[model samples]
Target: MLYKIFAAALAAAFTLLLLPGCKDQAKPSETAEVIYHVCQRSFYDSNGDFNGDLNGLREKLDYLQDLGVTSILLLPLYESVYHHNYFASDFKKIDPEFGTTDDYLALVKDIHSRGMKLYMDMETQYVTQEHIWYKDSYNNPKSKYSNYILYDDSAQTKPSTIVFELNSLKGYDGVEHKITTVNLKNKDVLEYNYELFKYFADPNNDGNFDDGVDGFRLDHAMDTLDLKPRLTGLFKAFWSPLLTRLKQVNPKLNFVAEQADWSSLGIDYLTKANVDRVFNFRLAFAIREFDRDKIMAMADSSFSATPAGKQQVVFIENHDMPRFAQVVKKNAGKEKVGAALNILIGGVPSIYYGQEIGMVNGDKPDNVYGPTDANGIPLREAFEWYSGETGKGMSVWYKDTGPWWTDRNMKPNDGISYEEQKGNKNSLWNFYKTVIALRKNNQAIGLGQYQTLPNSNKQVVSFLRYTHQQAVMVLVNLSATAQKAEVYLSASKVPVNRLGSLMSNKSASAKDRRVTIELPGYGVEVFDVK
Candidate 1:
């Protein structure tokens, strides 16, 4: 009778284990991560504010999450007289137009709560005339505030040396190979810059918010010329000590520089300065040649270009340039082909605002340059922030004031509004979304080592990404004609997963270490190698 009672109890426990509400039997795996880009000012209210507040950004977090984005990079938010917010007027204030300091803090808190990372674009090289340091320096160059500027001669331009006007110095007759200036040995300027650094480093001075930011995107760092390498050295010195202080608060902070060019000097600068990443301009310039083989070769050459792999930021356009749509309108297909190449090439891809919607410049000068309307605005005319009737008053980025680029404007409903393409599954928006999503879903593409396929056809470029556990081969058709791809694997019989193709739904099979597949024009295909 006791044995029968014990068996009954055991059977009851077994039944409970098989119940529908039991624990999940599946496990999670550690894989690669992804990041996305969007300008904060791209979203706004109906008041023609031309500023995007954190409150508005919070509402769109779902949109970003749906797109498989893990992080977002924001432009400068500090107070400024200009629209770009680069010429900081006050580092402490949150540009009244954007919102309040409390709002910014709340935004940061919310971002972390959502399990996303937020990076602030730090542009501290220049300040508006209204800055306290500028005002105080102009009033008394010998005062403590005067330490903010490094003066070369103090003779031609008395109070302080203006960086922009350095071209006007004597012997700089507009044709000399180089110009002379005071060595960055200016103790005054060094102390002042360090003080400015301290603000972001420890805004509250309680040593509580030193690492309040996740990463920094340095602006115009290379453009600053010092006769004695003083400026460069000073910048390098700032990083080690400054980063040390920041890491003390948050160890995951990232440091990046916007040097534009990937030269020996630029790479050396980042390495010596202890920066985590440097903008990859070399790749940007090389991709425009419209040769898939060449483009793939460039990616292979730069595998070890710097210390940062997968961490380097790959960008086609930023706030400083016209949307990539405007750039490759004549060769949109080629650029789109390049876009795929960027994804498979590795590194974190950064898309400028309006890239997916095909936003182009209606204003003259095509690229981002030329004049502006009094307030030093970067854009011209009003932009269609969203699509359909929903986006009617969602943005005031261009309507409130004249564009800094006077004759140019981004017209409303010009075939590139968010509404126009959101429903189209075949749209560029979908393409970008899928590519990013694929990166997230695949381990070989995301974290595996990259290897360029040998004997790449001129019109079709192929490469391989492999890890001990898995391998993926990518082949892209660069032209509009249907091209043939011969995929080879080190081992026998692999599964080929065709991506972004309209021709068919079948994935080709490999036999004898080789698989031949038809590739659609300007599309890519990925194969799973076993």
Candidate 2:
């Protein structure tokens, strides 16, 4: 761990106190969780079946626990023809390739036993050709399931396309399958979807969640249904009604909406659609930019925009985006800085698998694989579990099947995998552990409200996460060279005791309660003042 804290006598001089108070205290209902987002298909493999399954994830609970993650945000677990599990063929049925109902229930129980939560991604918007809705009503308006799907054509033969007018996609198996968006406008369709989700949240209706998932990630959530005139204001009609009902069953059930527009803050989904959380995509983009002004502006706006009891899920990468490592060109300092922003911020932190060891996208520099394959195949490659590329529990579902495997990201001796860096204290993996531990152990960071502080340096961004009883100050240097940051403390409720730090050099002088400290390029300094 790169963390060292030396507590000194505060009687001499004050050095760690930071900016003052926020008028509104944070709502602590669903805060303090470090979520580890997993594409299970690319994570652990327990059955030697080449595909990462529910049991495979259950087997790695200890690993995740050791990594300090409190929850697992799994990709869509419903039956989908798409490798990434987006276009589901069946919402009620578990994908046979992943496991069965019993496997899912067992995974849920194991997760609960560890005091951990599992959230499954659900994309009820679209369905593949094999889906019961699509199969039963694709070309028949007279079919009983006809209103279950939306069709653009008057004959009801042509189902509405999703995202870019494309109705077919070549999946991980290199097979093209047709897809269509579901009709949420229909009362029956909405009822069916709600029942499907409720069953997963409480399978037995015994009021026990051990046999069910803790929550659901609404993928590509939209109130307007891709700007369709007929589906406008679905938040009040479709989402709020459904989510309100789900919450009645399990008040602790977490719902996060992946808003269709990544550029927006998804605040509507939080307040209108009634989700507990939404991805802080704008902050994620700003972090990757590595500019102080952009990062500060976006981070401040993101945190401030959310309503009470709602939080932004801060993350650097998801299945749809490029890995942060590649975005930073594999720069170690930049990667560490990104880690700091993602974990130390006020919002609930989320970390993608393999991010701890700095895994980049599959280094495929070709266009042989079509558009669908090119988008996420590189970003969602199998987790490099061993020091070398080949090993047991290494999910090689796409190993010998695609050209993407030929030019892979998993290279022997690259020090990117967990096995390669587990023993090295200075490794990225250890750095992530240190930061995660810092967040988990500190009340100010884990459950505190975000408050921006005034700083003298342009290259450095300063802020505080605080509750009534605790406060933690974070000063980050966003430049490429070491810079001096003179920070000022105001009216906030800061501790009156000695200063302790995660800073490498604890040298600083306080005058007027402003401490000047030198931070290396992309260096982050964290202080627990309360």
| Deviation of model 1 at 450, angstroms | 2.4
lDDT of 2: 0.79
Residues 1-530, candidate 2, lDDT per residue (tens digit)?
Answer: 00000000000012223433343334545446899999899898888988988889988999999989999999888887777877788888888888988989889998999988899888888888998888988778888988888888867888887666667777657678888877888999889878888899899988877888888888878888767776788999899999999999999898998877778999889888889999898999888888778888888888888887787899988776768998898888888888999999768889999888899985443234644543466778888888898788888788777667777777897878889888998788888888998888877788777867767888898887877666677888887899987777654345423345755546444567676767888888897663
Candidate 2's displacement at residue 87, Å, is 0.5
Top lDDT prediction, candidate number: 2
Q: Indicate the residue-level lDDT of 364 in model 1.
A: 47
Candidate lDDT scores, in order, read: 0.55, 0.79
Off by over 4 Å in 1: 1-33, 46-48, 155-211, 223-232, 260-265, 308-310, 330-335, 366-383, 388-393, 403-409, 487-506, 509-515
| Residues 134-166, model 1: lDDT tens digits | 566554647565555444444323433334343
Q: Each candidate: RMSD to true structure? A: 14.6, 7.5
TM-scores, one per candidate: 0.78, 0.92
User: Native-vs-model 1 lDDT?
Assistant: 0.55
Worst 10 residues of 1 by lDDT: 171-180
Give the clashing residue pairs of candidate 1, or none: 363-408, 371-404, 372-404, 387-419
- Give the best candidate by TM-score: 2
